[model samples]
Target: MGKYIQQTDMDAYRFYLASMEKSLATIEKYLRDINGFCSFAGGRTITKELVIAYKEKLIARYAVASVNSMLAAINGFLSFAGYGCCRVRQVRTQRRAYCHANTQLTKSEYLRLVDAAAKTGDERLNLILQSICATGMRVSELAFLTVDALWAGRAEVCLKGKTRTVLIPGKLQKRLKQYIKRHKIESGPIFVTANGKAVNRSNIWKAMKRLCAAANVEPGKVYPHNLRRLFARTFYHIKKDIAKLADVLGHSRIETTRIYIMETGEEHVRIVSKLGLVA
Candidate 1:
């Protein structure tokens, strides 16, 4: 009924997101989702029913979590465009206590991934894996791993308009120093391409994928974010402190941290076995 999402409306929504200090990734995704909905609507009058129809189309093609993310982007854009009532309800699903087996990266597998990189004489990749796993930092924070941070034995990572401190382990600091010396890196991000720019996520992702075969780890479990989860699980195993771990992982919500340290299904089965309820 009201005018379809106009170019001026989209431009205003982008400015609104920037005013709220939304992360670049979030802003891009929201705008992309809004554009996709616009394409689907094809100048038709926008309504709640049309939104519901688009949601159904999404459900047929994507997982519930993915659909919810797209819906969230749509809702954010709608509210920004002064059509808040056009927002659709998110799909309801039970919370998962454990991640899928295919997604979980065991400590042994992680070590093998490191070894695989080293075996191929890829020093940078090896250190990248160790840096992320040891510090529980997001891949985007990799840019903060600079020569100065190495000397300081900690990195001040600023992400999503919030800054957090990530401590470098003594052994890891030593290794990084060696890497800096070997590469003759004077003062900049430790990980850089031949052109000396900070290594981007896509390059790191593809490099990690190449190690999957030699590491004997599943391809799905080899991304940079999984390394952070590995660190969270290991820290919780040793200290059993969820609250402190949440701080170290830069999460404002402990519930979000809980997702990182969920036990494996095998471990859950072992715990259930201890109950001895079955004959």
Candidate 2:
């Protein structure tokens, strides 16, 4: 005996999220999650029982993290819509001490990816991969790598209502300058299509996937975010400072940065075995 959430209420919820300064990506994800729940409920009123049932359905189809993320969106919507009592519990996930081998892109593999891009004469692809790794910037933040930022030796990345300065290494600055001169890019984002629009995440992802075979790297390890993670690991290896790494990566939480530098299972075992407990 409950009432279905109205379209007007959904629109208002979207406006509320925007007012809270949620990033475009986050807002879209929240809306998508809420829409998914609405579809599942099929115009019925959302209740605790209904939400619990939906959680069970999601458990069968998605991973724990994804399910929790979806639940977060639903909970946010419920709070906004005066249905807090109906909010469902998120699935608890075990902490991961190590990442799977297939997803962990090694430094050697990263070099191979760059070499492969160069061999193919796809200069943009090559530089894009290098830029993310060198700067340790997220793929989405590449839009900030404009000619002006290059000249200044730092990119001003604004996302999720926060702005941060991402420095460009001196060597990378020289290369980027040369690339700009070679391409005759007067101003604006260096990475863009012929139409002058900044390349989107999906395009960048597909471009990296295309390089895997030529690079002789596993396809699973060739995504753009992995390049950022590679940067995190490399920086941590050299500096061994987690706080500094978090600041560089623009992460509010050091724990989030730790995830980026999490070792693979093989590396974890090697370190654990060195404890000398097996005398």
Candidate 3:
């Protein structure tokens, strides 16, 4: 090991943390995963061979994306340590843009989910679920939503490292007002557990699973992100305005929003069915 690294390795790691803009949780994960790999490899220097072995070990136990992410963390830390390869064989995998079929919840199915959430009669849960379906806000965004943000007539969200505001309709505004009044919630996050901590994302995901079952909808089609994607796809299909949809989603790049507009892989089948020349 070099004089600088061996004497101040942890400080070097601290510098890496200071130089980046990642969240605390992500920073913790990157540090922990890299430290774990280093311990397993039993090396003072981060070497290409060690990284290769780590990659193989991760692949055997985790999905490609998870493996890749851990590798990226290790690679970043190693590079900062000044002992890593420029490129480590460039792990490749066939990544899908959409994890589920474009079930595109029919209006009735959408209503059914809302009705199921309504049956919970928690009032806060009902409003949160309804707001997500109505506005296409991410569940994480809803988890930290504030009364001020709601009444401001806009969605000010920080997602994908970008912060922007999304406009709300007058009708949604009225409904939100009524819900807030009924729940007697004045400040802090809109959705909180009985313990008063903001509702976590895991619970919201579980709620979606339950709601899907209650509505008799396919569990496969009921992820939290699906509500947002369905909003984008259904909105574009109805309005045919890509720019407007992009603005509402607060995407700086219309191209970024286009990925959401693309239909499921099944669309290729639809094209094959209609195009006789393909046969």
**Cα error, candidate 1, residue 125 (Å):** 0.7
In Å, residue 207's CA in model 3 sits off its true spot by 3.2
Residue-wise C-alpha lDDT for candidate 3, range 1-279, written one tens digit per residue: 562235277557866686665655577888777777867766445556667877888889988878878878877766777766532654697646553364655567777878888886645656666677678786667754677877888767876567867666688778888877777889877777878788876777787788877788888777677778778888898999999999887778997788777766676567667878763
Residues 113-147 of candidate 2 have per-residue lDDT tens digits of 99999999999989998999999999889999999
Per-prediction tally of clashes: 0, 0, 0
> Could you tell me every candidate's TM-score relative to the true structure?
0.93, 0.93, 0.74
Give me the runs in candidate 3 sitting further than 4 Å from their true place: 1-21, 24-36, 56-63, 84-89, 93-110, 158-161, 195-197, 217-221, 239-247, 252-259
Least well predicted 10-residue stretch by lDDT in candidate 1: 1-10
Q: What stretches of model 2 exceed 4 Å from their correct place?
A: 18-24
Cα lDDT of model 1 by residue, 229-263, tens digit: 99999999999999999999999999999999998
Q: Is candidate 2 or candidate 3 better by lDDT?
A: 2
